[model samples]
Target: MGAGRRPSGRCLHTGGIVMKVSYREALKMALREALSNDPRVFLMGEDVGRYGGCYAVSKGLIDEFGEERIRDTPLSESGFVGAGIGAALGGMRPIVEVMTVNFSLLCLDQIVNTAATLRHMSGGQFSVPLVVRMTTGAGRQLAAQHSHSLENYYAHVPGIRVVAPATLEDARGMLATALENPDPVIMFEHNALYNMEGELDETAGAVDIDRAAIRRSGEQVSLITFGGNLQKTLAAAEQLSTEGISAEVVDLRTLRPLDDDTIMASVRKTHRAVIISEEWRSGSLAAEVGMRIAEQAFYDLDAPLARVCSAE
Candidate 1:
């Protein structure tokens, strides 16, 4: 949306003003802005350079920013992640792409032991301004290895910030805010959302990462969710409207610092809450949010808090 660049193809809705872009294109816009606005920012990951990213999100970045800025690392996840952390420590802002959520496990030690703890361990002397972007969520197109929604695993850690952008505006804006945070940030881009198309204003830029967004408002019930499930929940809400069920939708955009205030506000208003998550039921983010709502808004609920999660 800035003078630097715009999404690849253009689509005019009405009045020939607004721009329509896919989730992948919006992400490319975000990356372009981050590279243009700051000198220290750079991207490094597998297939990110010559191959144009596993999902083709970085398709044209290498030509525009060059190989040095749009770098491609080796197959070793831990090694490259550790190098990213070191780059952050040395005053460079690094955005590392891990290809998928499952592959991120290969570098868990570097992420948890080093990147997540370095600031606390160094007594605030070190700050890892690193952003790790990876594909998450379940889909049949990509095999089992690339189909796991493991964002909850990263959200479980104490030091890093976890965010999933489910909308075009968020996909275009969240990266800048994540890059600005002094601590580490992990961005989970659902594989299924890559082709999603939506409209974004010309002036759209960075967005908030500290609060959850209330996507829809109602009174009968609240449909709480994030990531790809937000679209499913909103669609379900539309179907529920035909049945005379007024459902509110809350998007937990930021997973790590769960916005309890927003979640409780919705729960108290609806008096009934159902958290929908793509992760497995046991120890999922839905479980944690359900507990928070039950603990804080117990009296307001007409029935016990509920969760609809992946049975697998």
Candidate 2:
């Protein structure tokens, strides 16, 4: 019988301890840093100002930066998103929050059609250096509409970068990297991770938004996942370890440029894989990852790939 699973503890390096922050606080700090460091950077979203923020991640920002920088808009997602694109084109770095992934669909045209295609359509003459942040994943039982995982939709789009921060370090560093990029970037912050607490390793700053991270090392199987499912997948890995199955946990931090090297390396090493995701199995990010593994590491795999996904 499988033993009870002990949750995997967060990694906190204390060699040169600076400070620790909750996931939300880390995000706030990142936002503050971006706003302070760059006069061009501004945060705009629904209730992001007076109301603190949809998730309070932008809390206290308005006080420091004022309403001009921490602007709040109406319920119109498309209108605001389009405005963000225009703002970015006007030489401003805008961080637009869409409340949640469910609402982001209202601005699909702006995100997919305009923000993504501008640089290419203009033959590199125009660049949309914009960053869009939104909450994703379920767990709070916000019902059908509010609770859904739609990261795969954004990852599927071309000319835009998609990233998910599953740890404190990423939460603190990803935004800075996104702000510097010339292309549009979509950042998905798992709704359930807002309250997560961990120490930010001060040694690491401005992490690359183009690589996958190996959360845990193992030999028997590879457990690949991202966003909200990371902690749960790590816990599951610990459970498998008790049964003599050494499972490696790989966090696909950046979904768009899916780090083939890191993913293939793990798959080739473990020889077996299990992809975990909160999205439905059909056409999910997990499915794409599995396909990539099969295409590149088929000969390295000793067993068929597996996926643990949401129920249909």
Cα-based TM-score, every candidate? 0.96, 0.94
Q: What is the C-alpha local distance difference test score of each model?
A: 0.91, 0.90
Q: Work out how many backbone clashes candidate 2 has.
A: 0
lDDT of 2: 0.90
- Candidate 1 per-residue lDDT over residues 207-241, each given as its tens digit: 99999999999999999999999999999999999
- Quote the positional error of residue 232 for candidate 1 in Å: 0.5
What local lDDT does model 1 show for residue 112? Answer: 92
lDDT of 1: 0.91
Q: Write the per-residue lDDT of candidate 2 for residues 146-192, one digit (tens) a residue.
A: 88899999999999999999998999899999999999999999989
What's model 1's TM-score? 0.96
What is the number of residue pairs that collide in model 1? 0
